[model samples]
Target: METKSIVLLFIMTAFLTACAGNSKKTVQMAAKPIMKKHHSVVSQYPMSLPPPVVESRMRTVEDVVNNFGPYATGQLKPYFRKAGVAYPPREVTFIALKQEKKLEVWARDGGEFRFIRDYDVKAASGVTGPKLWQGDKQVPEGVYRIVGLNPNSNYHLSMKLNYPNEFDWFHAQREGRFDPGSDIFIHGNSVSAGCLAMGDEAIEELFVLTAQVGEENVKVIIAPRDPRLLPLDPEGYGLPSWTPELYRMIAAEMEGFSDAVKVSNNRPFYPASSPLR
Candidate 1:
């Protein structure tokens, strides 16, 4: 009888040990998954760079370009016409000059074809080309930003461009001259001092498109001439006329821009006159 009691006591002690081990192991196993999820949440929303509060906000031109196609069915329908060449509709496009006195919109994704939209422009006092000097009453050129929409303007509607960029200010300082009256725009029918003018309907459409995409995301490219007319090769244009020192400085700036934006173009290497096929 004593031997039987000893065996039964051993079994009970062993069972209790097993239960204790399992309880510790189960707690550790459950904690691992919880800890993993906690780490993931922390890594995704670090304090240094918090995630955007609103995911739908448009922060870049690329975002706007990629999304503009889906918004075309509304008032923007008129801007859509059958494409002339074999090209997919692009998201990021530029409308510069057209034979129909219109703007040509091209897409980054659309391979090669450009869409043409008729627009009326008020050229500076004399020409249809890019404005070079201040007070030439000419539109300032460079990569610009369209920031606001003016509904109560003398014109039907107007969108603002952030012009007179850093380069312009530098040039002005170097030349010891300041060009007065520099508020240029892509606006409505009240003839401009030197802004691009579109009809009321066109401006309204542009306003809607730009507003949907967010003003800060739009970039305006004002060139001496449309780049489509220039050559595409990077190695062939005769080098720019600059002293060794100036060339190095310019090349450095170009390199920095390329690195920051990951865009490489041959146009900078050649004169704007070279024909590109």
Candidate 2:
């Protein structure tokens, strides 16, 4: 009976030892660090220096020449000659007039931009106003820059615009807004929801020109009207209270390209002379 009791006690002790070992293992697991998911904007979406996607799709001068060789040589070269500007200008400016339905291309001259060509904005949704929020359908009226170039675009070749610039962001944040829609572009196809639709031929010229000049050196100015001729009437347009200040800022920038229209007076260099087929 004593021997049997000893064997039973040994079995119980072994069971408790096994349980203790499992408990210790459980405690170790609980002590292990729990990885918390990062939520900060910078952490979640780390800024990539020399963004890989942009670099991969970046167009070369040869690419531009190959795609738009004829137009660049036959048409654009003569236009630049007449404007007294060099071909493949060091810098380029795009002025988009919503009311006039015009998109003017300009090249850097001695001190200012000289007009190169003006293409009709085949179609653009919304009236004369700044794009307030996503789905507002308003063509944004502000200074923007070319942020991307898509050679293989659904709407033919397209040049993406940097909308919601610093000013746009500041106002949006102040107004407690988020998700101010994007993907604005100057593209081919004579149809638009809230973008500049400059037809196939026009977009090809623009795309080639932008590719040659380098997207970083291209500046885009979008406005309700020719600010130089007809000044912005905030009240007349029934714009927000803060718009007058914004208009003033845009007007100041527009003043720098006042002489751009002179290229229109130079008839010999007009696009009609050597139209892009």
Candidate 3:
């Protein structure tokens, strides 16, 4: 029994538990089918694109924008106003802390980034670490860009990410994992295979905001946890050996947002009396 237990423990530790590879294919999110089922919400937050899957047959970016643009834009006005920025800032940054299950939205117009709002991740798969291959179910942890937008997504609307970026490819090539999965996204809905599910309300705001600001100007930085608040201890998790280097890169970019809510929203990410600082 003792020996069996030890073997099982080793297997668990060796298992690469994470899922960043969505779409299950050769890159484009379009290649994946739009999920038939929906998990629309009703509360202070409602669904972005409601079901019967009204937009199921609907295609084209313009069609999506026309359908949901006004609603999304209207809803976002107050947030941008509260953040003291224009309707569409010059740029935006999305920071995801996987362990915290939180996503922070920051905006700027030729100045420092100011917190706009934060959202619950709703659903994401896998453990902490960079997405090494397809179906690992791990969320990729690194600096990335909004490569494209998917108006018709399996999990409602979604914004595509450049997961296998230069860093991802370089590492994969070295490691010799040729098919390092693709079609990663931050989409709506409450189910995730290897994508960040931001739910309906959040995705509408994000999707609309991304379109308004233009995809090129949007940057995404995903990390395991907020290093500023509490650094990650590699010893505690079943992660790869190269994780430290990847974390350092994430930390450097995150430095600008350490005082996250201060510049605009005034919602401090950390409590004033907290000892973690």
Candidate 1 deviation (Cα RMSD): 18.5
Give the per-residue lDDT of model 2 (tens digit) for 224-254: 7777665777765467667888889889988
After the best TM-score superposition of candidate 2, give how far the Cα of residue 147 lies from its true spot, in angstroms: 0.8
Please provide, for model 1 over 174-221, each residue's C-alpha lDDT reduced to its tens digit, 9 standing for 90 to 100: 765576346677876736566767766666657656665566545565
lDDT of 3: 0.80
User: Which residue window of length 10 is worst by lDDT in model 1?
Assistant: 256-265
**lDDT agreement with native, every candidate:** 0.50, 0.78, 0.80
| Highest TM-score scorer | 3
Q: How much lDDT does candidate 2 score?
A: 0.78
**Candidate 1 at residue 190, lDDT?**
37
Residue ranges of candidate 1 with Cα displaced over 4 Å: 1-73, 78-93, 98-101, 106-124, 128-134, 230-277
Using lDDT as the measure, name the better of candidate 1 and candidate 3: 3
- Which residue pairs come into collision in candidate 3? 18-126, 18-136, 18-137, 18-138, 19-137, 19-138, 19-194, 20-138, 35-154
Ranking by lDDT: 3, 2, 1
Weakest lDDT window of 10 consecutive positions for candidate 2: 268-277
